[model samples]
Target: MSALGMQSSILVGGFQYWDSRRKGRQFPARGDLDPLIDIPRLVPHIILIDVRHDPLDFRFRLIGSAVRRNLARDYVGHWFSEFPNYSASSNIWPRHCAVAESGRPMLQRPTYVGPNKDFIYVENILLPLSVDNPGWSMQMMFLEFISKRH
Candidate 1:
């Protein structure tokens, strides 16, 4: 089983890639990943978030095409706090906070609450990305959608 105990091949693959990049460090630097050259097929489903502190907020550094299509908006360069329906008390925020603070991979299975309710849920792997400094990092998120029954 993968570190996150997930069975989805896509999630597993993403985890494997992130794990491989670690070398010996607890987390890999953002510069370590090149979506086009390394994970081309999974590129469209990836989202990169910039972690900010002194209040703790997240910014959309990069939103993949597939993710944008599903959300029906391109949120690149926007903060998560600016998104509609976003609340600090929301269930999603803590998951992110945990990963950011702990520098660990987290498996998230959140039901579809976006524009399209036809999807049953989404499988997401949030992997922490570190720089040279401590307490400063980004998050690499990989997602897969599951459709609801007819």
Candidate 2:
């Protein structure tokens, strides 16, 4: 929340929703996530990434409506490499891998967008979700754009 200032209620709210369902586990399982119940009003700000390690792939499981609207693109079922000249993906993908490796939630705030169609700021909250075994299979991302007004 540095340059972006305090965490927006949307982010806090998302965290609360995610944490409440944690039940003391390292991370919540993908099945535990119910979009309608977990983030009822922030669908556009949410994203789900399917993680793979055999060849290291990060594919989009879901893309929030808001993201599609703001980016003017729908990345569902696409990997970051599928899009070229997109700097944000380059910056974000590594952190995602880190979260998967650590099996912990990671935060990257005040993510400045550099003239990518429009100037914007976003905060990335990546929560690792595991289906079975000890490796993470899903990355529940709350990619929230902080209001530029503040």
Candidate 3:
């Protein structure tokens, strides 16, 4: 199994507690809740994709503006290959695929290269979203800064 596969398994197993806690609360649909109400509650930079599609064709359906600003562009609807480096795509896509395929979540700390190739550490949560569609197309992601100084 890939490193991401191992991480996905661990995250899924650990999520039992998280799910239970969430169930105890009442979180409405995204449309029903205020967009800015709990930005911190869900880390915003993480990327989610529709696993049923080719990773090269997979689009990010949801993204936070904070993430967009950090990225400096609209990454939603873009392919992972479009990222600055092939290393970034290779490092992230497999783990993303592992979680989506297993209906599990994966925690990843990815480094993004900023201006002048400065690396920024982003802690991310990749959550699988099971929709009724036959293709099983969807995933949710959350991201936060592990170190602002990065």
Task: Put down candidate 2 lDDT per residue, 8-100, tens digits, no spaces.
Answer: 676666666777777899777777778786578977778888887766768887888766666646778987667663323576667777987
- Give the TM-scores of the predictions, in the order they appear: 0.90, 0.80, 0.61
| Candidate maximizing TM-score | 1
Runs in model 1 with CA error above 4 Å?
Answer: 1-3, 132-135
Q: What would the per-residue lDDT of candidate 3 be over residues 1-150, giving only the tens digit for each residue?
A: 144442333233324323443444431122222324433434344455654554233566668754666665666777666674432456666776676567565667777654423436665566655545565466666555544553
Q: Which TM-score value belongs to model 3?
A: 0.61
| Higher-scoring candidate on lDDT, 1 or 3 | 1
Candidate lDDT values, in order:
0.83, 0.71, 0.52
Which pairs of residues collide in model 3? 43-143
Which RMSD does model 1 reach against the true structure? 2.0
RMSD of each: 2.0, 3.7, 6.9
Measured by lDDT, the strongest candidate is 1
The superposed Cα distance between candidate 2 and the true structure at residue 91, in angstroms, equals: 2.3
Instruction: Give the lowest summed-lDDT range of ten residues in model 3.
Output: 26-35
- TM-score, prediction 2: 0.80
